[model samples]
Target: MRLQAEDGDEQAAIRAELEARAVAGTLQLDAILALSPAAPSSSEFDFLSALGPVQRQQALRRLLALLRNEEGLHVGDASRLADVSSPNFYRLRQLWRGRAKSGLGFLSGYAGRPTRQPRGVGALGTLGKLAAENSAFELADRSIRGLSKLIQEEQSARIPAYTLDAAARHLRQNARNMPDVLAARYGFRILIDYCAVSLVASGSDGSLKLVEIAWVIEETTQLILAARPVLDVGGCVGQQRATRAARWYIGRCGLDVPGPPAAWIKAVVPDPVSPLDRHHVDRMVSVAGEEHVATTGARRFGRLVTDVIGPILGRIKIIPRATLSENTSAANVRAFGRDILDHQSIRARVAQSVIAHNRPIIDMLRDSRLPLLDAGDRTGTMTSTLNDLLLRKG
Candidate 1:
């Protein structure tokens, strides 16, 4: 009993001294870490070492705590402590995890992006790379690329990126703007009515041979706004394909959208570009001329364009479905022709052709515009074209 009291009193005194030091700011960052017991850690701190010892220690402590799931640590706080954006911080963490457990692991990998142009290096490389730099500018004013080109030619050093990004992203746009600009003269929406073009591959393995393209193009501007590839066919595949294409450009191109709570069939237009056959084309066109769009025998397959995707889509009157000779808009004619005939070539064909068609318009916007087919209301629903946009019909 006497020995136990003496030991307890000794432990209390030691703890008091430790607490006093902690209160006086003498605690080492290496102590009390959430990580596995340290085994002689290296002094290295990787890219963060540039933050200097004081800042780095603070960041490292917070990071280890956050990883430990300590009481109040959070992702945002962790990122701030590391003095990096959330994305960059995640990238750094991933790099760290792939290597040794030593703190010196930060001494390597993921050199930061270069801040300035490398003297004689070209202003840009591929469209994919260009898109990474400025998706918004690619989404807007086609002239932006021309401007970039001119700038590169005159002075190799390009303008600051944030300035350009802000200017492009802030451009005013709405569901009604496209109609006011492109369709005011025509007084109606122009939709691309067509089908799949079998891409001729050299090797001919027979997989992904038929590439159906559903794309949205801004007519007057000759801009293929958003495009997604549909590698398959039949049933409601076109519906999803069409809806995805529209969803990308709908709001961006001044057409508001979504579909498929219950898409009521209105018409089944044949692939004007490559119809299945003469008889099939004749039959479909004849049926399309009827009083109401037919939905007969539609049960076996998936949603039709008229139902799931077309209604929102059928309003892009920037181009006309009329004969190319009669279609006055050059942008419309270019897009229609590109869709019908230009998707050929053995190597780098589709991407290159698409790039040729829509160079300035970079990666497509991915915000949700339409609900997936039959996502809501089992009985189904319909939509109406409003100001070159589609609204759910009440």
Candidate 2:
């Protein structure tokens, strides 16, 4: 074609027309919209701006093929051929497809799949509405039950290994002047103190494991409810203080309790004060150790809740087939109908829901307060054995 010049003429008009067509998504409208919004804009540019250079060129080539095809096509026909919607093709008209539109929604120079009627739903007819309703109910029931159990498990404690281990460590460290039985009692006492500190620390930092946070919130709420008649009592200073602090913490965070907001308890706890003396320090450590062991049992309880409720979850699986069969017998009807029910879309949605509901539980598993104990057990056992050997040699 002749080039356009500074002066307006036939060549300039043709150039202007071509530019408009290019902007309209002349041929590969479907392909253009499929591109990221950033794909290239000019036909002479040889690429979709949204696509990278290499893919842009490839897209250009595909558009060119669609443009050059001699068989005429309507917007609907073009969409069917390109596996895109007719509406998308229209939007792409000015943005660039492959070639300019020869007519409204019709590709002047293309021949592709001749339109035909949609396939029959005979297989689906066999299942009718009854089977779908039944399946829906079953899935709903399972999902609700599974979700309820999952929530309960995430907020409770069951195992006490950490609490116990903390106690043992404290006793070992400071039992020089005490009998073994007396040391054990001191160790247990230390565990309780440590547990209190840990709870306070976790509450302060909003870093308690999700289940632990939930438990704390629930227990604190219950305590507040139970103490309504005794909030004015002289002995309830610690209790009242803790309750007020917790409520203030939650309120300042602008979060409602019994939800993910409970996880913030760890962030609300104040930092530990330094031990006033060696004796006090030892007592604090011993108490904290015992508390850690007792809290470990919470994880076990969480797991049990998960086990009990997991079965109530909804499940859906999709299956694809090459083509519908000619046979319409009862057995064939049942089998084919079941196969069609396997839709990947439904499964994907379910996966999303599960992730959303179980987020807190997963977060709990990652808390630092709840490190796995296998490594600790191995180290402790090895240390004790080596110490025994050294003592014997001496």
Candidate 3:
């Protein structure tokens, strides 16, 4: 019978042809049995496709032997048809009998390789919990040897480095298994950090350009509020541009000068600060209030840039290189930045990437039962205060 073209729906076609052949008394079972076991019918081929070659051949041979027996063939004749010795035929028959009693369980592929009940499953579970509770960036940065050593120290047992690596990979694949951020007393803090990212223009003479990116992250929620690309028209990021960006963001949040900052603003800037840069920091203080604005250490700051901000940007291909080199040209940087801003679709794409990255973290935060301040609630307070100040001016 000709097999139907559609997969998984050819059973009816096969059955109809078999019944028609049987009614016409033209169904030669012996001739069908004589066909090579290596080449199977469509249905049998589909069933054995997933099995290894040896297992597939063995399954077909056993099936042929069963069919011969059903035809009332003697054991010796069935053994000859199956191309097996008499003793081996009896052994196969015994195995098949047990499997048939279990409803043809032998067709489910190899019965070898006892079920994969992992040893030390409890230890692996604990390892996963430990890896998740710690920073994913930190865990990923650790060397396999280092991770193995740490695991041994923590668990007080010698576990293969490969095992620890697999556990870490599993944790990363399942984000929900990771630990949640602790809820802060005052809403969420925004951690602002600057990093240089490499980008190559889309042209024949496309050369690498180092673009500065400013990452604004909410602390308690662990959500990225913004990832604005800093445009340096003068070939280098200056205090004026950085400060202007900072001031604009703070103002947009409706925080007034000489008033309590809506969110704690901490910037991680480069070491050996210039007087002009110090002036920028002073300006941020005036806007965000003295207690809120502070600079983090260069080393700790570098970790945040490389581990967190760098990876997120890398995933979207916005940054060509994962880490920018020291000698990256600052020339024509503003042109690229201007291009990004002028193109509304490009801006929207970047915004979408930020939103996608934040969704999982937001869900995790919500699952933790942490109280999140509503955006409307915060905005209403700022708007009312600004209106009162405006009325006073009138």
Q: Model 1: runs farther than 4 Å from truth?
A: 1-188, 196-198, 201-210, 215-222, 252-352, 359-394
Off by over 4 Å in 3: 1-124, 128-181, 201-208, 232-265, 270-278, 284-302, 307-349, 364-370, 379-394
Tell me the spans in candidate 2 whose CA falls farther than 4 Å from its real position: 1-7, 10-54, 58-123, 126-132, 135-137, 140-394
User: lDDT score of model 1?
Assistant: 0.34
Ranking by TM-score: 3, 1, 2
**Candidate 2 TM-score, true structure as reference:** 0.18
Quick one: best lDDT, which candidate?
A: 3
| TM-score of model 1 vs. true structure | 0.24
lDDT at position 204, candidate 2:
33
Which digits, one per residue and each the tens of the lDDT, describe model 1 over residues 1-394? 1111125567456434433433443434444231334422434333343233343455454344334323344667656544567887676667556445223324222122212223223333433244445533233334433534533444445656533322222221211223333223111222323333223212234322333344433333334433444443432344334544444344444332243222211333333333333333343334233433232332311122211122112112222223112332345434432322222221123333433334322222212222323323222122222111221222
Q: Of the candidates numbered 1 and 3, which has the greater TM-score value?
A: 3
* lDDT order of candidates, top first: 3, 1, 2
lDDT of 3 by residue, 351-375 (tens): 4455445555555555665443343
lDDT of 2 by residue, 1-394 (tens): 3233334475446434533444444534443323233433444332133232333333443343244222344666555444446676564454344333211112211111112211232222222332234333232223323433332343344324333222222222222212332222211110010111000111233432110111112211111111111111121222223344334332333222121111211111112243332233233234223333222221222221122222112121111111111222334234422222112322232333233333333233234232222322322221222122121221
Error of 3 at 310 (Å): 7.0
